[model samples]
Structure formats: structure tokens, C-alpha cells
Target: MINVLKQASEGLLYMSESEYPFEVFLWDDSKQKDITPECVLQKVGLPVDTLVEVVELDSFFEVAIAEQDWHNSEEKITVKKYQHLVQVLKKYLFDLQVMRFGKINIDVYIVGKTSDEYLAGLSTKVVET
Candidate 1:
């Protein structure tokens, strides 16, 4: 778990799928390999007993991935879908900070590139609602 957080702290994104407008990806370096929100909370230093598990978020994500036509696509995110995900994360995991868009490395993967290169990029994307 520390390795995951260590990699994430360096600004390496965890990409579940690599297209563009990456869906099912976590830029915060807070996610474990399993990509469970519960694991995210755990990584952010939240105690296990206090976790308010939202199983629905996982289910929603699975549905979203299945519904999307991912064939040869570059632009992958819909504003509505992105916003909904942010809202859900905010609601369930308020303590964790959202990843800034400028911090995203375009070359995303499940384990990330293991570099903090994107941290030096522009902070054009607002993380707040």
C-alpha cells in the first residue's frame, strides 16, 4: 500500500483504461491496484472502521465502462459523467483532494509511468466544485 501511495505521491496516475478523457482512472495516487473507493479511503489515512463504503460507486463505474464504446477512441470523457464521478467522490471521500488536470500525464496506465513529471505542469484545472 505504501508503494502505491509512494508512486501516487509522485503524481503518477492509475489508469484503468488508456484512451483519452480517461475513465475509471485515478490521478490522485490514492487508489490501490484493485481501484476500490474503500482502498482509496484507506490510502488517504482514513481508519478502516470509519469507512462508509459506497458499493454503488463501483457498480456505477462498471456500468459506465461497459456502456461506453471504447474502440479506437481518444476523447473518452463526457462532462456529465466526469462531474458525476467527482460529485460521488466528494460526497463519500470529502477529505481526499481531487487531482488537478494540469497534473495529469497524457501517457496514463494502470500502474502509471511512475514519475512526478506532471506535477510541474500548469494548474489550469480547478479541483473544487
Candidate 2:
């Protein structure tokens, strides 16, 4: 599963106002019940007291990969690769959610439960000015 994720996320960058690479991670101890903002913080070794904002996966993607340059071949290819990555995640995981931790430069976790009920997905940083 990790290999599949690595392959799907290869060369894909999550673009906000800035571009960032997606890093795949697998939490062997994470369960389906641990798919909450609070749990996400702990899983990622963040302070439990830190604030976290939950955003829907589709909404996050729509903004992250917003249409910028349809005519540019490189941009077009990147967009398609991101879309494909999303599809791959959906195909392999369930109960997916986007967890945004902090303001300005936010830590984003696009996480979901694997077939074995463990948390597995990609994490990235998004700088919003």
C-alpha cells in the first residue's frame, strides 16, 4: 500500500500560493476512530493543545489545484497528475479528510483509513499569505 501511494504521489506537488511536495506516511497504530482533528495532531507529533481546522477533501483540492494556466503544457500535466493522485487515494482509502494545523504556513495532512484500518496518506505544507 505504501508503495502504491509513493508511486501515485511521485512528482506531484500540492500547489497553494506556493508549491510543496507530498510525503507519504503510514501510521501503523492509527485506527479508523483516530481520524479526527485531535487524533491527527497526536499522530503527527504536534502539541495536543494546538488548534486544527478540518477541511473537506474536495474543497481543499479545488482551492489547492485551482485553475491557473490551462494553456501551459507543464501546468496542465501537473494538474492532471494531482487529479490522478486524488483518484488513487480514493480508490485505496476510505473516510479521507484534510487536517490543517496552524495559520499562515499550515501543515496539511490528507489522511484516511487503509484496508487494515490504519492511517495512511500524504502530508504537505501549504503557505497561505
lDDT (CA) per prediction: 0.32, 0.84
Error of 1 at 83 (Å): 0.8
Q: In model 1, which regions exceed 4 Å deviation?
A: 1-77, 98-129
Quote the lDDT for 25 in model 1: 35
> What is the TM-score (0 to 1) of candidate 2?
0.89
Question: Best lDDT goes to which candidate?
Answer: 2
In Å, residue 43's CA in model 2 sits off its true spot by 1.1
TM-score for each prediction? 0.23, 0.89
Candidate 1 lDDT (Cα, 0 to 1): 0.32
Identify the leading candidate in terms of TM-score.
2
Tell me the lDDT of candidate 2. 0.84
Query: Cα miss at 112, model 1 (Å)?
Result: 19
